[model samples]
Target: NLRFNKVVICTDADVDGYQIRTLVLTMLYRLTPTLINKGYVYIAESPLYEINTKNKTYFAYTEPEKTDILRRIDGEKYTIQRSKGLGENDPEMMWLTTMSPESRRLIKVLPTDAERTAEVFDLLLGDNLQGRKDHIAEHGAEYLDDLDVS
Candidate 1:
């Protein structure tokens, strides 16, 4: 009997955070897929940027969202900064943006397309080196911005 009905995975909005999320999700899918299949697993969406004006602070989880926020606040003087990691965030901001059930955003991990999900996971993380190489060769350009060349 599990004590919690929902299991939420929270991480930063960066490359390392993405890797960590992938590894943990892969582990969970491999070890206890029931959690995912039962709709109990979720990923907490963290903001990538925090936009602050004189009176309001807005958190944007994606680049498009940041752009939208900026456009909405046009003509207003504001400072936009990359959001710090979970540990580095102040307690109030952390709670408001991530921990609060009312305000937080969550993506439910569903295996609705089980075969495709499995194939992609195997191609990227399994022992299919050639397949992984081929995939990157074919689709790498779509994710070039995500690569951390720095």
Candidate 2:
């Protein structure tokens, strides 16, 4: 048996990536919840933007960070592009942005209350179809702006 310290979930910084991450977490929460309870699960945050300058490259994970990066550059010529998925990124970029412990940002998966966590999982992913619908009906309005209707 192979021993491991942490189970990191790394995906693209996009909608599809968020869906995949949720599914993986649901599987883990259902099959081996101990990993989460014991603090062995983590989510590796991927950068949303890649800002390339004449001499350097900066990875920004959030809009504010990207703004800050641009502010720092202060009129310096730079090209900003949306970061690609992990599968598309080069080995060096992946290593620098994700695999390297020093540079990577890991959000620990800590479920403080097992009961509440289980309820949420069951309501959303379990066989409770009605519950999921009801939740969407109640909370979906808050996320309407996030929808990609186009």
Candidate 3:
């Protein structure tokens, strides 16, 4: 396996982005759990909106942040730009605001609760997790050991 010091997941700042990010994290959690356990996995935090007044520019991550920024400025005077996806951002803007080392935001993915995370992934994978849990409780490790070895 190719070993990397870090894995950064960059997605748009929206519901779809969140879903895609979750799927990626789940895959990594199962396939390369050490990546998370070693604090090498991260999610890039891109802004949902960029608000620019005549004097200043602000990046907003949520609706409330946008609202608060607008409330502080003259709505008619300032221009508010919402990012639909990462592609919508210009390279300079994306780099300076989302990718630059000095000001960029990143959320490290750590396996604080591996068991719960595994359970959640099982649920996401659908139906089988509950059955597996029930089966384990009823039959115990002895039953699992009895399965035929290939």
Candidate 1: worst-modelled 10 consecutive residues by lDDT: 111-120
Using lDDT as the measure, the top candidate is 2
- The parts of candidate 1 lying over 4 Å away from their true place are 113-118
Task: Identify the leading candidate in terms of TM-score.
Answer: 1
Candidate 3 lDDT score at position 98: 79
Clashing pairs in 2: none
Cα lDDT of model 2 by residue, 1-150, tens digit: 329999999988999998787778877887888888888989999999999999999999999999999999988999999999999999999999999999999989877543355677678878989889999999989998899989
lDDT of 1 by residue, 74-123 (tens): 99999999999998999999899999999999999996633355567788
lDDT of the candidates, in the order given: 0.88, 0.88, 0.78
Which regions in candidate 2 have their CA more than 4 angstroms from the true location? Answer: 113-118
Judging by lDDT, tell me the better candidate of 1 and 3. Answer: 1
TM-score of each: 0.90, 0.88, 0.73
Off by over 4 Å in 3: 1-4, 74-76, 113-118, 129-150
